[model samples]
Target chain A: MQMTKQEYSKLVDKKSPPSKKLKNCIFAFLIGGAICTLGQLLMLLYEKAGLSETQVKMAVPVTLIFLACVATGFKVFDSIALIAGAGTLVPITGFANAVLSPAIEFKSEGHVMGIGAKMFSIAGPVLVFGLTAGVVYGLVLSIFRLF
Target chain B: MPQRTGHTLMLPSKPSVTGYAAVVGKKEGEGPLAQWFDKINEDTTVGESSWEKAESALVRDALALALDKSNNPPSAIDYLFAGDLLNQCTGTAFGLRDYNIPYVGMYGACSTMALTLAQAAIYVDSGAAQKCAAATSSHFCSAERQFRQPLEYGGQRPPTSQWTVTGAGAAIVENAGPGPYISAVTLGKMVDYGIKDANNMGAAMAPAAADTIKTYFEDTNTSPNDYDLILTGDLARIGSDLLYELLGRENINIRDKHNDCGLMIFDLKKQKVNAGASGCGCAATVLCSYVFEQLRQRSLRNILFCATGALMSTTTSQQGESIPSVAHLLNITI
Candidate 1:
């Protein structure tokens, strides 16, 4: 009557439903493409507004982050991501949500220990690795320039 | 007289459930069992500023309602067994602190309802207490941040993952009542099948549930057909299937008589609850509402209520430890 963990896991896998990865991927691609296209459209709109290249470069992400924050506050981003999957995740909007989410969740604990400390809980790993990779790339480029 | 039959405790006194109440949040209020709940809070916060406090309020409201229905004062209750999914069982501690009742905080994760109920019945059956109350709650918002993710975090839950029911249930058990009595009880041992994936809790807890149910049947010399129902707490779709498979191996076919509180609470097609609803509240609220109602109506005369719990903390899981689970069974008869 007793089964090993491996056997039990197999049984569990057999009984449990499999994830629809193909369907998820298709949804992710469509929604991700749509999000990127929206970003491109925003860039074009900013250009039409006669903003400088630098200003437009900063404005695009700022606008997206602002929208993400607002959507997160209204609890709409999670619903969107439920269908969009990684579509909304692999963008700047996802990062905004990651940061703002804990900020909102932990705010009950108080400003100091709650929101301030846990604000980056989800996005903290990304920041650490991203900054480390940037530094490593800069170091490699600087050493190559010396040659 | 309390007679011990292997792992089952035969309660000859048959401590009866006198009062019961279920309180749930907005999401659960929209579920199929909405009408069954005594009170449904449209606000997830339950008018509280924090989710932890709100969860406490759920437990308090449920216990208060149950006591109110039983016409029992707080001083009349000798023991109160309550617990929740929060760390250190803060929800129960805070919720019942002001009630001035002798409180016993319990921790069995999702199986808390059955654990509390069985203990309450034991206390009453053994003549240690004339009256006892069992209560438990689980808040989705509180559990999400503590166990899974932040409320606003944008991520997809796996198909096997179950949603925590934001609700609470309470019942008052006494030596004398109008029936629907606790006739027997079986407390399960920890069973681990090395399920490391926290998302697939049904797989982790199913082994324990199977072990407990099989043991109960063996101890009592009974079969699935002997009872009107075999109700499991919060096993949902995947765990229930696994339970069937595991029990099938032992020639114990409960598929015909079985129903999980998780599956009964929510409509999976519309609720987006993946496999089904989970948490301590899943079983607690269902038992306190639907099952008790059915018992009262004589629709379900005899039943076995088994609540399953996964005993793995976040730290243990993060340290690569497999989940060990338990299931406590209570045989109730009207």
Candidate 2:
């Protein structure tokens, strides 16, 4: 009826299925690479259209995120995510899903509290720190440019 | 420790399930068992501002339908045994607050339905109450937010992950109603089989289900084949397979009539649910809607409903703690 934590752990470990680490790793690698390649293709297409470097940089992410949102709306992205695992999480689309899904799910809750508030739930921290880093880089660059 | 036989509790008087109701969200409504459920809310929000409120409304809608179907006024109910996959069972307390009946909130995670029914049966059999209500609810959004990642996170679910059934089920048991009766109940003991993967709940809970069902068969001296149907809650595919193998080793072949609410609640082939449907409502909805309909009509008999639960908190799982799971079995017969 009673046992040490170690004993209990042993009991649980004895019954659990063995992990397929090699298979999981291979899938994560392949999928992660694919998602990144898709993002790169958007950038390449923007470059071919003779867009300015700044416009291309902005347009690429916007297209990738929009595609991710569309795939999520169609319920196809989650299917890809099922197999890709870390590959999905590592890509920008994964972040897009994080921002879009909750907002969409809680859409009925109203804009202020639902979309406005929850849209930033998972990706908020990333946005905050990322923007802050960008601002810091811009400020340092501007100061050097002036010098 | 006299080998702990006779753990089974036979009723003093036959307890009958007089009324029941099941409700779910649109996703579950799209499942194969859609037609069987009493009601399905088209939107996950249920016209509520927050996920918690939506869950409370699910319990409210389900209990209202159950009480209405039973043809009993709210005042006729003696006590309400209710719970949900929420902290302190807040969903239960909040959902049923409008009702003046005495309430007893319980928590067995996903196993709340069977646990409540078993207790409600015992109370009725003991003449503690002429009519008692047993209810439980779970919302996908609420449970996901509480137990795992917020749906807003849109986290990638593992193949082992199960979709939580966003619904509520309510049933009223009485002494002098209908033919199908609660004959016996076998409460399970907490068993930790050291499964640490929070994503793979079926694996974590399979051993506990095996242990409970095995002990139930041993104590009652009943064979699996003797029952027309045996159902386990929320084990889905993986856990159900393990259960089959566990029982098979003992020469108990239940493949002919065995069902998992998880697998039954959703059409895994068509639905994206990798493992199957889960949550407290998983068993509650399937059993209350489909199973109860069958039993009430005398289409089938000798049903063993065992609801399984994975008892772990966010903190515990985050701390790398192994899951402790349990199952409660209620033998229903006509």
Candidate 3:
């Protein structure tokens, strides 16, 4: 007889322990706070890099993507991300990190097709929208100024 | 014995049934949502009692509406597939139990409604069950207390933050029916877009919705124009725009019929639901109460309901990890 998804879910649950609720909560608090600290450090680095405001803005996201790619290669980002929750994603850097990490992790499937192409798997559309919206906004602002 | 005569046995064309449903929490006024409508009104924050009370009320209201339309009773329901965005699914569990129907509790973050409907349809089609009732619920106070903190906590929310609505919705699917039936379901493959901020769930979930919608069209050989409506769970405003952009890349235009239940549930100006609403209950309440009613009234026919979810754990969030999301789609045909 074929087992249903519900039945399969139940069977899987039987193998796992229901306990460890407290330990999980404690770990989440500590790890999540630590991740936020890393984000704060990155923000400081962006300010102290002695670059102009515009360059700092660009560098922040770029630096995050680089770090995330490295972390993805080392298989350490997912664990850290798990604890940081939304703290890691609030910044623009988090978005870059998320995009590049997946590409690096999936590189094992095939670098040219997988890592190189898929790295933008999630971030591709965001960049497209950002660029498109930016151009539209600029055009609208210019038109308004002419009036 | 002589050979059989002219009678040909015709097999029933594989029973195809699919449709969408939604339910809303507030009945015109009288909840936390009511305060959003009138600035002069008192209740700024939802109370603890309101959460518990609203969950039960919404469950009853949504279930009654669904049953009246489906013409099915509590007894006819073979299984009650239900869940909520509350702690341990308290609202759904406690509320559903009052009906005295046996149900299996499920949790898939915000994707509960679509997931439950998909599971129910599978059971009916496989002959494992004749009828099933799928339901999901959410309450603002309950969700805040469990997921974040108390309503009085008064923390500043990020721009991407979405308000949680207090509501519930239910759908009933049967083996035989003239009503719309569930046709097909596609479970999403979890995608982590590295969104560490919980505030902007729309960005995190939009990609999942695009991925699932693309896959569904591919797997079923159905084009975007084939359906009258393609609804996403909680894309709200920002995510809705993102979804449109993503689908455009595939040469699929969903601009006309595409809508987000999160954006539809409340009036932003009146209700002050910032960035609209999220959570499993957001789609559940809207689809059952509003969308299902319209469908039954013959306003809608074919609908593709895709519910999206952020599956990040508190542990992952604390670790500054990115958010992973999943989406599930149910094709409903009238």
TM-score of each: 0.98, 0.81, 0.61
In CAPRI terms, model 3 is classed as: incorrect
iRMSD computed for candidate 3 = 19.7
C-alpha lDDT of candidate 3 relative to the true structure:
0.66
Question: Which candidate's DockQ is highest?
Answer: 1
Compose the digit string of candidate 2's lDDT tens values, residues B130-246: 899999999988988777764545355666789999999999999878846888888898977777888878877776777778878888898887899999999888778767765
Per-model C-alpha RMSD: 1.2, 5.4, 19.6
Q: How large is the interface RMSD of candidate 2?
A: 5.2
lDDT of 2 by residue, A45-117 (tens): 8899999999998998888889889988777776777677677777788898888877776676688997798
- Residue-wise lDDT of candidate 1 within B174-281, one digit each (tens)? 999997899999999999988988998988899999999999999999999999999999888999999998898899999989999999999997988999989999
Model 3, range A80-137, lDDT digits (tens) per residue?
A: 5544445444444357565666554454458888668767755677889999999999
Span of 10 residues, lowest total lDDT, candidate 3 chain B: B1-10
Clash numbers, per candidate? 0, 2, 42
Which numbered prediction scores highest in TM-score against the true structure? 1
How high is the CA lDDT of each candidate model?
0.94, 0.84, 0.66
* iRMSD, all candidates: 1.2, 5.2, 19.7
**What are the per-residue Cα lDDT tens digits for candidate 3 across B84-163?**
76667777876677787778888878899988877777777767777888888776755764566323221235445677
